[model samples]
Target: MSGPGTAAALWSALGSLPLAHLVPTGLGPWGDGMARLMLQPLDLLLLVALVLLAVQNGRSWSDRLALVLPLSWLVGGLGGLLVGRELHLALLCAALVTAVGVLAALEPALRLGKRFLRGGTAALSLLFGLVAGSSLAGHGGALQALLGEAVAIAVVTALLLMALDPPHPRWLALGLRLIGSWIAASGLLMLGWLSRQPL
Candidate 1:
């Protein structure tokens, strides 16, 4: 890799969960801002990829497990934005892990009869509920902060669900692409906003 490619690779790695989770704790103010912006694109990209993977692998338990990867990212990203650390949003992470494990454990049911997938469905539902609950509770009584976090989380989560569950496959894919593109654009806007913020 060279030039922008190298820079992009390094940034992407830095923004991954292990490193990104540590940034705010380890660095000063500027590092925190850089970490947030650097990770946004990765979340957006994974959102797009997971949507496509779910559609391609449709109705399979493996597809459901693939779905958890994006769910985890969405939870972690919004959780980080809202609460600023993985520890504050540990519930969300736990829910995601449970959902993924449930999906894996139910794979045989999906292949052989589909009864086992019920447990996975319940796990996912519970995860969703936990994520919603934590998000609402995270803002500590400020209306503006509460609304902003709720809207961001809902938009990202809804976009993922819609992408994975479009009634018409053709229109679904196209719609998800547009939504994912919009998310990428929004992330860019956030970067600009962060840059211009008073320090």
Candidate 2:
């Protein structure tokens, strides 16, 4: 039972378990990376929250988000790949997501200036991207998966920017805030779960 065959079997069994954040489809690493956006959707939620926050403020510089967010993310992710390990920062990440959600939900009241919003967006994106990259580092085709995820993020961000441009109608504005609250609630649930599970 303790032979090499048994060890190999144990390793295979461990690999089969869904412990990591990355979900693999049969469509290779790139596809897995792209699918990771939906399968593991914190990235998407953050992107949405950021977009909502940006559009609500109606700053001319908001246009830069389409470029700024993804580039910072890619750079952070590359740094993560170089580190080559996962960070056990579930609680911190959950808290950050919750805070961002709150910020998006309370955008009108907050009225953060252009400089703060721009800087905050880049910093948050970079941190999240680093976490994502760290998660993928231990997997096969990590670089490809990271690239695929980055591409997906860029496309989604661009599309969101296009759809949710400034001067939103009343209903659309309320809907964005509502979605932000939901994301915040989801983050809270995540925090509660992490508190109990400690991972």
Name the top TM-score candidate: 2
Residue-wise C-alpha lDDT for candidate 2, range 5-26, written one tens digit per residue: 9988866654454425566686
lDDT of each candidate versus the true structure: 0.40, 0.82
Error of 2 at 101 (Å): 1.0
Stretches of candidate 1 off by over 4 Å are 1-53, 61-163
Worst 10 residues of 1 by lDDT: 138-147
Off by over 4 Å in 2: 1-21
Itemize residue pairs with steric clashes in candidate 1: none
Weakest ten-residue segment in model 2 by summed lDDT:
12-21
For residue 123, give model 1's deviation from the true position in Å.
Answer: 20
- Model 2: what TM-score? 0.85
